[model samples]
Every structure is written in C-alpha cells, then in structure tokens.
Target chain A: MTKTSAGKPFPWHILFFLGPGLLIYFSVSVYPLLDTLRLSFFHESSDGSLAFAGLANFTKLLFDVVWSEPFWNATWNNLVFFFIHMLVQNPIGLLLAVLLSSPKLRLSGTYRTLIFMPTMLSVVIIGFVWQLLLSPLWGITENFMWNLGLEDYFDAWLGKESSALVTLAFISVWQFVGIPMMLIYAALLSIPDELSDASVVDGANPWQAFFYIKLPLILPTIGMVSILTFVANFNAFELVYTIKGALAGPNYSTDIMGTLFYRTFFGFQLQEGSLTMGAAVATLMFLVILLGVALYLFFFQRRIKRFQL
Target chain B: MKNTQMQKATKTIATLAAGFALASTSFSAFSADKLVIESWRAEDTKIWSDIIIPAFNKSNPDIEVVFAPVPTSSYDSALNAKLKAGTAGDLITCRPFDVSLSLYNKGNLTSLNDLPGLASFSDVARSAWITDDGKNTFCLPMASVIHGYIYNKEIFKELKLEVPKTESDFFKVLATIKSESRYTPLVMGTADQWEAATMGYQNFGPNYWKGEQGRKNVISGQEKLSDSQYVKTFEHLAKWAPYMGRSYQSQKYSDSQNLFTLGRGAIYPAGSWEINGFNAQADFEFGAFYPPVPEGQDTCYISDHTDIAMGLNANSKNKKSAKVFLNWMASSEFAELYSNQLPGFFSLSKHAIDLKDPVAQEFLSWRGQCKQTIRNSYQILSRGEPNLENVLWNTSVGVLNGTMTPKEAADKTQASLVNWYKPQQ
Candidate 1:
C-alpha cells in the first residue's frame, strides 16, 4: 500500500506496532526465564545470602544421593506420565474427533461441547472432584463398582506407590483429552469435500479414505499436538499438588518435576526454602522442555509434510 | 463601625480554626498506635476477630490491631519472603522450632527478654523460645499442642474395652475392634504424607526411644535411628498397619477425620489442634489418651510441642504498641481466655487455667504420670537438614505397606540423614 515506504528510510510504524507486545513479552516471559537461569548458578548461604556456586546445584541434583534420588524418581515418573498421555489420551481424542467430524451426525455440537467441558474447568477443581470420587471413606467409586458387579476389583489406586502415578496420569488425561480432540476436529473440518469424494471415486472405503487421505493430511496437526502434549505433561503440577500435596505421598510415587520444583521453592514440612535450588530445578525443566520442542521441530515436523489445502 | 465588625469576625474565625486543629491532632494521636499481626491460621479468624482482639482492645484502647491471616500451606514461604523484604507485620506467627530459629538467626525477630511477661512462662516453655546461647529469647510461647490417639468413647464402651495402657493392651484392643463387623480399628489419612510422620511415627517414637535423652543422643550422633530403640517404633507402627485396612492409603486427613466423626472408626491418631474440629463435628462423645509403650515400660511420654508462637518483628515501627500486645498475650488473663476459647490447647504460662473440656482435662491428667515429654523429632532436628518428616514418611509408608522391614526403614532414614547432615560450624 505504501510503495513510498520501500524507498523511504527504515520504517518507524513497524516498531510502533510491534513495540508494546515485544516489550511485554521480554519483561514477563524472556526476562524472568533468563533471570531464573542466572539464579540457578547461585546457592543460598546459611546467613540467608546468595552466593555464586557455578554448577554445584546441578551436580547435586544429578549426583548427590539425597537430591538425585528424588530427582530421578520425579523424572522417571514424569516420563511415565507423558507416555500414558501419548498411549491413551491422544488416540482416544483422535477417535472422538473422527466421530464428531462425521457428516449428518445427530447432536454433534452437543457431543463436542459435552466432551470439551472438562477442559474448560480448572485443573485444581478437577483434581479435587476426582479425589472425592475416588476416596475410600466416601465409597462412591466402590459403590459404583458394586453396582457393576466388580466390587472386588475396586482398590485404592490413588494411594498405592505402584499405582498412584498412573492414576494421576489417567486423571490428567481425562481432563485434557478434549484439547487434542478439538484441535484434531478443527483440522478434520479443514479438509475439502472434493478431496474425500475423489478418494471415494478411486475405490477407497471410508476407513481407507480416513487412513490414506485424511490421516496423512492431519499428520502435521498431530505433530503439533504431540509437542503441545510434551510441553504440558512436563510442566504439570496443579493436579498432583492438589491431590497428593507437596510431598506427593505414598513415598513420593506421584512426585513429578512440577511438584518437586514447588517443594524446593516453597519448602515443605521441615525443609527450608532454597530459592537457588528451586531455580536450578526450574532451569532444568526449561532445558528439558526446550530440548523436547527442538527435537519435535527438527525431526517430527520435518517428516510430516503439510498439505496445501 | 464596619472596621470594628470585620476585626471581631476575624478573631472569632481564628479561634474556631485553632479548636478544630487541636481536635484533629488529638484524634491522630489516639489512632496512631496501630499494630499488624500475620498468622497462617485463616480458620481462626473468628477467634482473633471476635474474642482476642476485643479483649486486647479493652486493655489498650489506643492501640488498634489488624489481623492478617494466610493459608497454612504457603504461610511459611510467604512470611519468609515478607520478612526478607522487611515488610512483615509487627507481630508475626511462626512455626515452633527450626523456622523460629532460622528467623531469629537471620535477625528478623527482636529479643523478647525485656518483656515483663517473660516471667510468667514456665521453664519448658521459655526453653523452647530461648536461643542456643540462652542469652536471649526470640518469641513468646503461646500454646503447646499434645499429640495422642482420639478414640470414640461410645465405641470403646460398647465393646467393653478398657483404655489401653501398654503396647500389648493396645494391640488387643485393635484385635477386639477388628472382630467387630461394623467398625474399623484405626483410620489414618496418610495421603497427606506429613500425617504419617507427625501423627503416626512422632507420636509413637518417644514411647520406645525413652524421651528427651534418646533424642539428644540422636542429635549428638551418639545413636542412630536404626538402633533397636527406634526400630521398635517402626515395628509398632507396622503392627498397627493391618487394622488400617486395604484402602487406608487413599484416606485423606479430612476423610479419616470424617470416618472417625461418623463413628466408622474406633480411633484416630492426631494432635490437639484437631480437638475443636472434632468436638464440633462428632455426634458421639470422644476422648484422647497417650499412645502406649511396651509392657515392661512403666511410663509413656507425650509428644508436647509448641504449636504456635508470636514474635515482634525487628522491622516494626510500632515496637512499643506491639510490646504491649505481646505482654497481654503472655499474661494470665490471656492464658485463661485462650484455654477457654481454644479448649484443648494447654497454656504454656505459669498461671493455671481450669480447662473445662473433658478431653483437655484428660490430657492434663497425663502430665505428672509420664516420665518426660519430648518434642516432635522434626522440631528438635537441626535446621537446613533434608526434611526428616519427608524421610520418616517415606520409610513409614514402606514399613506399613510391607515393602520394607522396620530395620530396613530405620536404616533408610538414617542413610537420608547422613546424606544431608552437615556439622554445625
């Protein structure tokens, strides 16, 4: 629109438009992240002063028995948590998206709204709701099992060290599945009607059409969904904190990086708050999430080609 | 004639203005002595807003008190940040031992030695607030919480079970309760990990470890928790595990409390802080008793720990007014009112307040009978060490779940302490 701008000096309006947003982004997001990284290199002295410790905090987190044990435990639990979401949540979300995207489906909008309802509620509220439903003293879940003639199978899964993490992961999956469903459904809706008709004309059945045509087209969206899930699963804290508390009880079985970071930052029970160690934990979390996003971008995104439509 | 009238009017206006300024100055002076107190007990807003503040105002009407309450979970961190920033309240509520020590060491709290009310506190209460050098006191000890088993008196009477005095008798009582189809022997809310360590292990440990001397030995590294004395505590805990049932792990603190209040459980092991909540909620009458020791042991020790303490902030501008409030808080009148208001909490002062609550009276009856009282291990352990509460909770859960023996659990806890232990410089 302004050919004269091509011949003019450097544009001022461009910066004028972008300045406020960039400034806000730097102050709120980038600055704090960098500051947290800087703080991770320090340690809190007994006198309540900050002293430079280089990589000592990281070394302790990775090697020292007291710190490393819980660190590794949380890291492992987080991986299991992420894997469960991948194995269970995304697939179910995909199935629901496929069903909801069907032509002439009755009450399709209503079903979509109902399915997405949980995602709209706060994670802490969802955590407490599930906690109440699963509570043994209340016997709600047990009574439901009794009605279904599966009373013997009912156990306090949320309390056992072996099952606590998995139970929490499933709860997270239940609340967040709607997100992937909506994203995939939007991607499915973007497909052209002519393309599906052409696939059918080529003797492809509905299943084959979905597999060869629709699935391939939505691979890019799925890749995006995978990375989103990776970031979210790694950063999760509220649900675990709400239910298992800061200790992530039953011998820290439900402990994840988020809860560990919170405990290290705030101090729980008898532990004194160590801001430097908390920053170190947070820095490690950032590096992990960054590495995951980098891997997804470099490898997964490169393999999945986006269709023109 | 006009000039004379103008002069009279000017004089009258000046007199009125002077009177108004004097009244405003007096008003400012009267309201100037405002004090702020911050605490973690948000639920106790009524106690402060209704009774304590009103009573304090009666004595010091010129001083206005503002109560700032934070949720317990995040209170320590919030207070620590505020203290570091030199913006905390004039009077601050602090956790008993380590947290108080840390704040005192950092010079965030003022010395309370000069307060005349310091004379009223007992040696034990004074000892909890005194520094290691014994030259200064940092806070006024407000109340001591006693931990024990709160059992349904109705259930015990219905079953014809005598109040247990020995470990064998306690187990027999559990067995008798287990024989009943309707009642659970014990209800524990281990979901909140601190409960296992605080209510279960700490309450039971002193009985076997022989109280203060044993704790001092552990602190001095003269003995380890893996030793027979401490291992027996874990063993006793494990012995009581089966009675908690299969679903015990999932039971939250609130759930366990509900079960006990609803008459579904015979016994709920908790602290004196729960007394008010239980009394208000329970339909049936309940009572508390100290956890039993081994049969040969004649004395059982109660875990008596300072529940809450208040200190004058070093940064407070209204130090004189805050001192007046603290003095009142430590007075005999405050003690009587405190015991009446929060019925189960024992007053730490020399003045005796006749406790009306039967549960409070029962706990008091154990005072002379026990050999000695010991604070919770986490309270006595050195600050900056990896949390013993978390370590004990993990090991205790392992012992209860049959994943580890008492010896193994004890050894693991010892190992954790050793890993995090640093010699005092």
Candidate 2:
C-alpha cells in the first residue's frame, strides 16, 4: 500500500506502441541523414578510392576555383529563384485569395479550382507546355500577339541569357501560385465573417478593413507560405533541367544549386561522375535548408505567433 | 488447438517453398544459356529483337539472346550502378571512347584482343575501344555515323544550286537561298548546344583541323586550340549564324528537324544518323553532302565518328554464349543485315556490303573519297575538368549566338584545356 508508482511494474506497452514507428524513423530518416554527413567528410583520392579526409571536401567545394565558381553561381541563382517567388508569386496569390474569399462572390469555387490547377500538374509537363507556347518556331505566342496587335513585343525570352533565368522563375511562379493561393484562401475562410463585418460597421472601407483586420489575422499563414516557398525554390531542379538541360545553358545562366549538384554528382556526358562530390553538394543543400528553417523559427516564426487569431 | 494451427501454417509454408523450387528449376531448364545484351539504343530494340537475335538463333538453337535496352541519356549512370551491383547484362554495349576505356581499366570489361572477328575492322574503327598503348581492344566496333549536311533535293533544284564543295561556294549557295526568301538557308540551332558543336563545328571543322593529325596533335600538346586552324574553325562556325533560321538562338533540335522535313529549309547540317528519319518524314527527295571544305584546301577529312560498340562483361554468367553472339556481330552477315536495317548507322567492319538507302549510300561513298577520323575531343583530352566536349559545345554556341568572337571562343576553349590537361598545361 505504501509502494510509490515509480516502483510499480514498468509499462511494457509503451515500448510495444512505439517499436515500429521508431524503428522505421531511425532507418529511413535518421540513418540517411547521418550517412550523408559521414560521406561528406570523405573525399575521392587520385586512385578513385574514397578516403576519410576531414573537411577537405567542404574546402574544395567552397574554395577550389573550378568547383567554387559553379557552386557560388548556383547559390546566387537559387536566391534569385526564391526572391522571385516571394515578390511575385506570394502577393498575386494573396490578392487572388482575398478576391475569392469575398462574401457572395460569383463562381468563387470555379475561380479557385482553375487557379489551383497548375500546381497539381507535373512540373515537366508545365515546362514543356510553356516552352512550346513561347517558342518562335511554333509562332503560337507571336501569332496570339499579332492578333492582339502586340506582335512587336514578342521576343525569344527563354533563349537569351539575360532573360532565361527570370523567364524560368516566372514560369515556376505561374505553376506554383496555386499553393499559396489555396493556403491563404483557407486561412481567410477560417476568419469568422463577423470579424471583417464588424470592421465594415465601424465605417472602414473594404480595403481599409482588410488591412486593419483580416490581413493581420492571416500573417501566420503568410509566414508559413514564405518558408515553404524558400524551401521549394532552393530544391527546384526539374523545370530548368527539362527546359534548358543540365548545362543550364545560354552560358549556364539558368544554372541553380540543384542542377549543379546533379552535374557534379551524376557527371554530365563528358564529365565523369564522382559520388563523394555529389554527396558533399547534397550535404550543403541540407545545411542551407536547415539554416533557413532555423532563421525562420528564431525570428519570423516567433513574430508570426503574436498575430495568430 | 494452437499447436495444430501452427503445424498447419508450417505445412503450407513448406509446400510453397517446394513449389517455388520446382518452378525455378523448370524455368531455368526451359531457357538454357540465356544471354542479355544491355544497350543505350532503346530505339533499335525492334531491329535487335525482330531481326538480329533471330538470325543468330537460327544457327545456334541452344542459346537465347535477349536485347535489353535502357534510354540513351541514363545509360552510363544505370550501367555503372548495375555493374557495381553485379546485375548488368552479359554483353555490355560500349560508347566509343573514354567510357569503355575506363571500364577496361576498372576490370569491368574483359579484353577482346583474342576475339577472331575483330580483324575485319581497321585500326581507326578499333581505336575507339583500344587501350592507350594500343595493345588491347575491349569492345567490338559496331558502327559509325558520318557527319555531313542532308539537303532538300527539291529546294536545291528549285534554287538551281549545286552541292557546294568549298566554304565560299557554300556561302554563295546560302546567299542565293536567302535572296530567294522562300526557304531557310541553314537549319540549325543553339538551344540544345550540341548541334552548334557537332553539326556546326565538327561538321565543317574536320577539313580545317586535318582530322586525325590535328586531333592527335592537340592531345600530345603539339598544337593548341588558339592555333590558326582552330581559330579558323570557329570563324567559319560563327559565320553560320547569319545563314541559320529565324530565332535560331532558341530553335531546338526538334524544331530544326521539323523545318527541314516540312521542306521549309534548304540545307540541314546533319549527321548521317538522320537518314532514316528524313527518308520516312520528308515528302521531297533529299541527299547529303560532306561539310564544305575551306578555300584552297585540296584534301578533305570527314568525322567518321565511331558511335556504337559491344564488349564482354567481366562478371557475365553466360560468357560462352555471349562470345558466340559477339562473333556473329562481327561476321559479314550481321554487318549486311545491320547496315540495311539501320541505314544511317554504317557497319564499322571492312566488309563491302550493298546499301539500298540512297542517302546512306551517298554518305558511305565519302568513306572512299575522303580521309576519315573520329571527333577530336572523344579521347584523352576530355578526361579532365572543364571537359573539352562540354566546353566545345558552349563555345560553339557562344560563337553562333554572337556572344563570343571567334578569337574569344578560341581563347576560352584553350584556357579550359590548359587548366587541367597536363599536355596543354
């Protein structure tokens, strides 16, 4: 009667309940992550054998002229890719969400579905469709412009080095706008109608009410969307690879971190592949994403919680 | 009751295990001596399964040859992984140069020097799969593709232009076609980048580089990319921009193909591999001409690039049947069948086979008329970083796009070579 609960028989069911989940998590997720970290520490030697070389791989990736040039170029392109998503994609999505969420809006469901359609389609198909439409060889875009009397404005946007990356970024944004739109739309719908309606009774205009009331309520959703965009943009590879190829050409203008990682790891046609180098690049990508998520958690995420409805 | 259920489960498991053992024995017995040939040429699956394997089987009924192909683009990586895992095919299809050489060095490929049928192929054909010392040939050379322009015969007749033999004559023809205004003068593009190098540079640059002489010189550091001949090659390639189709900067390989096939273009800078596709698609009659030589050059060279070859896998279980199949691949019968079936891919063997495809025959005729050599960068030079082939592709694209002057292009190419290649360094 006096025995403490801690001295009682241990709960064997606890281990039983968690066994499968822990086992799978350790094998699939934790094992690969730790293994990648281990592999990154090793470097390929002259004889094609991988030896434990401490930080040699990282140093070569960051400082070796041949390796560093493409690495930095890709990192910079990835930043631009993310920035385009932030500046163009998120705002347009927000605007569409607000418009769709208006009370008694006609065909709001149809508009929402139509806008969200591109996100569900495969990136490769979207890239090809956009490439074909913009192609001067097909003259589809040029012909459409001709009918509208704006034919003079059409240019080979994808072909030019100056415009290739930006064009790709915009195409990517077009395909993914639905993601933010749906998220924000759902967030806006969750805001009780009475909240905005009360602001309307206070004699504030629709835009003013949106800014003062509904916007702040959706700030947390927007924060999540931004972080999601950051991760997706940096991880992007397929669209550019499908369109411009592995070289990311017109002088590697469209080259991004993912493509560089691919070319380094799998080796382009003439360049022999090195698995260690590819693993090192992959480790760097993981760190970049980790650092980004950490920053959001420590800074933006905390600020976001204060505005949560 | 519990003991009886466990006994029943054990009985079922034992029965299933026995059944599987029986099935596997019968399966292996039915398909004895099966050999799998792994290749990158998935498009040629029909030809291999329908024609080539059957002929071999007709003579040797005991052996089964399975044609297994993966997509061309992923072949190298897939093959490497499979080889490592000991799951690759018995007969491995080899790419022309460094790839197979590496395989030999890695002991993944067995030396084929002792294979009897190799004598029919010349030194140049075998050169692709040979060791650096020229002692061991690892792969049997299967075929080569000759680099040249496939032209619309109707368009040439319409413009009253003869096939241009020299660079100046070629330009005069381009000018005439341009002035005519109905058709594109040159159907080529920079979007894919390789066409600029392969079709534009290597297509016309052979005559300038002097083929094997210039190629070997570059490898040995006897010559440099900035040399007069190399620079001149870029100059001719750069000039091609003006003659190319509209929006040629972005025009893709498929677009160029459609333009030429639709009879909208006059001359297609082409590899002879396109003979079959053009024959099937083009409504108008067409023919090919070797890359026009520059002014005052009496001798001509063509990039008779050795493309496809086959090698014995070191780890193959069915090596006996695989060797038999390889020997048949080298025979005159296989050569004739392969050449006739795949028109553009000329058999690398010295056997004089009759070819029916008019365009292919025209290409084959160049073998007797011109000195034949492979692409310069395929060998030792491309083994290092800033890979010469990749560099050539971009620089050639830059030149075509007017982003780099011929001198700039030449300098850039040489700079990359000097960075890593010990001979150039």
Candidate 3:
C-alpha cells in the first residue's frame, strides 16, 4: 500500500502518520538536548547576560580544583553506586528469576507479583520509607535485630558516612531489582521447552540444562538489562533527593552526579545558580552515557550471540 | 431547504452573541472587587476553609478573597517563577526582614510606607520590617519569635542539675545528663542542612561582642571568617559536637525534635517558633533559657520577631484591593486572631496576648534583655556563592564523628567560602 502510494508520487499518508510522533520527539527530546549542548559553550554574565566561552566551561569543570574535585567525587561515587547495582542487584534478580521459572515451584505468579510490587512505587516514596525504617530513634530496625539477638550490630546505617552510600545503594537495588527479574524471566520463558527436555534426556541436571540450554537464549536480555541499568543509574535523582537531600550529607559520602547537578544548577546557600556550569555538567554526563551505550551496542552486544531456541 | 438554512444561520448568530455577552460580563466581574493574597505559609485547609477566608469575606462583604499558600521551601523560586510568568498575586507574604532588600532593589515589590497602624508595633519590630532607606515600609513585623534551649524540666529535675549559665556548665550538664541516662544528651540534627546552622545564629550575640559587630561586620566585608571571634564561634560550635548524637549528620530536624519530645533526649536547642510543635505534648512541657555564650560570657540569645509582611506584586492587575487587604492584615484585630488561633505565635502589635506557655513566654520576656543580632552565615548575604550551610552541617557531623578538628573544619569552610565567592569576583 505504501509502495502504491509512492508510485502515485505523493507521500502525504506517511507524513500524516509520522507527523505527530516526530513533532513530539523533536520538541520534547531532541530540542532540549541540543539546547543544553549549545548552552555548555557559553558563560553566564552578572547582569543577566550570556557570553560564548567555548571550552572554558569544560576546563573549569575538569581543571579547576574546587569544581573538578567535587565533580569527580560525584562521578566516582556514581560509578560505585552503579557497580553495586550491577554486581549485586542483577545477579540476585537473575537467580530469583531462575528459581521462579522452575516447573516444580508453586505460587510463582504470587512471588513475582509481590517481588515486583516495590518497583511499581515512586522512587521518592521508597526512599523515605527506607529512611524511616533505618532511623535509630524509631528503633524498628534495632528491635528486629534484638529479636534476632543481633542488637549489637544495629546502628543507624543511613546516618554514618561509612555506611550511608552502601545503604542507599542497597535500598535502590531492593526497589529496582524487579526490573531485571521481569525482563530476564520473560526472556527465559521464551526458550523452547524441548531444548531443556533434550538436555535432560542427555543426562544433564537442571542447573546444567539452564546453563547450556536456556542461558544461551537469554544473553540478549541480560545485555538489555545492563544497558537499561546504565541509563537509569546515570539519570537517577529522586531517591537521593528524597532521602539524603540535595546536600547528600554524612560528609557528602552519598553525593552523586544527580545531586551535584542539582546543587550546581540551582545553587544552595551562599552559591548563586549558574546555568552554564549546569549545562557543562549535563553535557559531560550525556557523553559518558553515550559512550557506555555505544560500547554495549557495538562490542559486548554483538559478541553475545542470541540462539534461536 | 432555504428555510432550514435560514434557521441554522439565525441559531449560529444567537450563540455567538450569547458567548460575547458572557465573556464581557465575566471580565467585568473579575475587574470589580477581588482581593488575592499569596503566602508561603502552609494553609491548613480546614483552618482556611473554616476561619480565615470566612473572616476576610465577612469584613469585605462585596469583594471575593483568594488565598494561596505555597510551600515555604520553594517560596522564593516559585515566587520568582510567578513573577516571570506575569501572574503574581496582588499580595504576597515573605520573610521581609531577609529577602525584601534584594527584591526591592530589583523593583519586584511595592512599598507600604504610608499604610496606617504603623505606630502600634514595637520599635524593634518596626525597624526590622522597614527598608534601610526609611522610605518604604516593605514589611511589617507580625510577631517576634524568641528562640533558645527547650529543655525538659522533668529531665533537669531528675538529674538534679541547675540551668546552664555558661559554656562550661552547658558541657557539664550534657555530661551529667548522658551519665544519668545512657541516651544522647544533646540532639542536634544536621540532615536538613539548615538545622545544622541554627547554632550559627544562636552564637550571633556572642560573636557580636567578641568582634564588636558580629556577622554584620563580616557580611559588610570589614571582617573575615579568620578573625578571632569568628574562630572562637567555630570553636564553640565544635564543642557542642561531643554532646550531639552519634548520627547527628543523618538525623533530620523533625527526627531530633521528635526524640526530645518523646523523652529519649534531655534538651532540644531550637527556635522559639517550635513552641507550636512542643505544645502538642500533654505529658511533658518544655522550658526555655538563653544558653550561656562562653566560659566567661553572660547568657545571650539570638532572636527574631514572628513576622509575615505583605508586599504587592509589581505585576498585579488588582493592586488596590491587595493594598487594602495588607492594611487589613496589619490591623490589631487580625494580628490578635492570628496569634490566638495559631499557637506559639504572639503579635508584635500592642494588642498581643499573654500566651499561657511559661517557657515560650519566658523567651518572649527575655527578648527585652537579649541583644538583637542579624542572621549571618553567608546564606543571607553572599550574592554569588552556593549554600555553605551544608558544608557547615557536614563539618559539624564530622566533628561529632571524630573525623574533623574545629580548626580544620573552620579553615575548610573558609576555603570553601573563598572557592565559591572569589571565583564570582
């Protein structure tokens, strides 16, 4: 039908179909990114003017000790946060998915639903709930520990600089692990049962069957999960904002790029907000994410061949 | 067919005519008699629906009154946004003693210099609310908020301790309290960042004497943070760290307040404004005192009057009604109603009632003797730096955690200040 329309030398139908989506994508997504990129090249003036600064903004962000140190600290902290999610969260989610997928398992649907429930809530709500649960004065956590005869180990994890970042990271993982579980579970279910049956008939155990038969089929999904986690972790803001606040205190042990971006752009107490500096940070963040995504797509993804099981 | 077309045309004309008439009437209705006010105070929906709106409605029988209360945290940014959007309300309430100066300089606010009932307020309150140039009554102090330590009298009685009269007494009491009860002796919350700096203003009176002008001189750039008094103030702040809870950095403002009220802690050092929250306790009531400034210093408290002053939006279409409502708000009757109904509040006007809470009233009485010091800590005055409040907050946390020395923290703070401000210059 489209070829016939093209033969008629008028692509009016295609334009009509694509017009709304194109308009929305360009307006909401592309325009803002381009605008932010353009803004990173300029410096803001005191009398509410903007001047072109070329690489000056980037140089300030990198070489200027004050900005650079905090920026790098936030960046490194963000990496640690992302590392925790990938190392701990994804594996746990994958294992849970495997168990839930077992043929002998009962109430798997219930387990999946209950496990995924936390992910459905907003990040801010989850953040505050965790903060309250960990608060020492409330003693709910300590009480639980007391019941378990481990009260000595109980402390305000969120209040200590040593533990705050890890606690927050773990909380984030607890909320978001369901994402990987659902995605991997879907991919696992798509594998033909006959392949697993063949593996079992060949004297392979359940674990072996999963590794050799089903695992190969779900590699694509794992890659997808990694990329999704990369984007979400980098773009994260709400959880930290709601819990640790914009300052990301405990001597800024929990400070991340998102909070840094907000503080830089909006300026807290003595600092005035600078849009140009904010833009520079944003541009740099975008480049980091883009490079990561590109690496995943071009190298890691292509190597992990999907089996047509 | 012709007759039917003629009938359709007639119907269309009638509809358009009706629409035009409705639009014109609505416009005229909007133009005539409307009073709109914007505030940063959280309007308890029940209270507004029952009390305030109806009272205003009764006073201005023919006019309609619209009340909008924005969240306090986002008030400045939101107000600026509204100003940019050209839809700011006729009357806006803000902490005029602080922000009105810059706002006035920008010509975003209107002056209320000639408004009646100016003579009824305390001179201190009047001076605080008026512009420095003396031509603009940019704000009027609604009430004077006196703040100090809110200690549980029951706890002090149990410990057999007297009220601390000096810095050494303060530490001794904390140590005694901690020994008597294994709970945290002094709970200072630094999570909100602003809460951590509450001690900054409390130290203002002491800093004033030591430096001869305090934060005012520092803000004016006549003195630096390295000055002896400033260093001493930072030292005093460091001393309190030992007494604070282990997780003071992580404890939220509300959390620490809750701990004190629940009898888990001995003292809650906070603003007099918290009287409203503290009054909810039926089992234990708090007592107030101006904690001694230092080892040799006399008791001095930092204080500000309870004030919500109305300013007209430069962009308002209904300026006349706005000014009228502001005048009405500043009236004795309005202040009395607000003070009486809103617990922990006392009017700055001559008509202020004697609140029943002895602790709150004690602070109020002490206001006469206490030296009025300006709020400084770089937030209020530093034009270009980001909030150093968090740095101060973290430093206090570090001191409590035994990770930083007071001198080290002070130098770091001074460096941070230079890093943030010097670049702008």
DockQ versus reference, model 1: 0.44
Lowest lDDT block of 10, candidate 3 chain A: A265-274
lDDT of 3 at A195: 83
**Interface RMSD of every predicted model, in angstroms:** 1.8, 2.0, 3.3
Give the per-residue lDDT digits (tens) of candidate 3, residues A83-193.
Answer: 999999999999999989888999999999999999999987898888888887664787898899998998778877788889889999999999999999998888888
Question: Could you tell me the TM-score of chain A in candidate 2?
Answer: 0.93
Q: What DockQ results for candidate 3? A: 0.36
Stretches of model 3 off by over 4 angstroms after superposition: A1-9, A41-57, A269-272, B1-38, B43-54, B77-90, B96-144, B182-184, B200-212, B245-249, B299-301, B305-308, B339-357, B378-380, B420-425
TM-score of chain A of each: 0.96, 0.93, 0.96
Q: Per-prediction DockQ, in order?
A: 0.44, 0.54, 0.36
Q: What is the TM-score of chain B alone in each candidate?
A: 0.89, 0.94, 0.82
In candidate 2, stretches whose alpha carbon ends up further than 4 angstroms from where it belongs are: A1-23, A45-48, A307-309, B1-33
Measured by DockQ, the strongest candidate is: 2
- Please give, for residues B1-425, the per-residue lDDT of candidate 3 as tens digits: 99999999999999999999999999967766675667766733445557766886688776677777776555665665576467777777656354555555556677766767566666656665566666676665666555567788888888798988777788899999877786678867666656655554343334334422555555555665555655566667667766787657668877887888888778777777677667765268568777566765554646554445667776677767776666677777677666655655567777757566676667767667666554455234445343455566666556556577767766766666666564322
lDDT, candidate 1, B71-129, per-residue tens: 78778878877887777989998677777877887788899989998888877787777
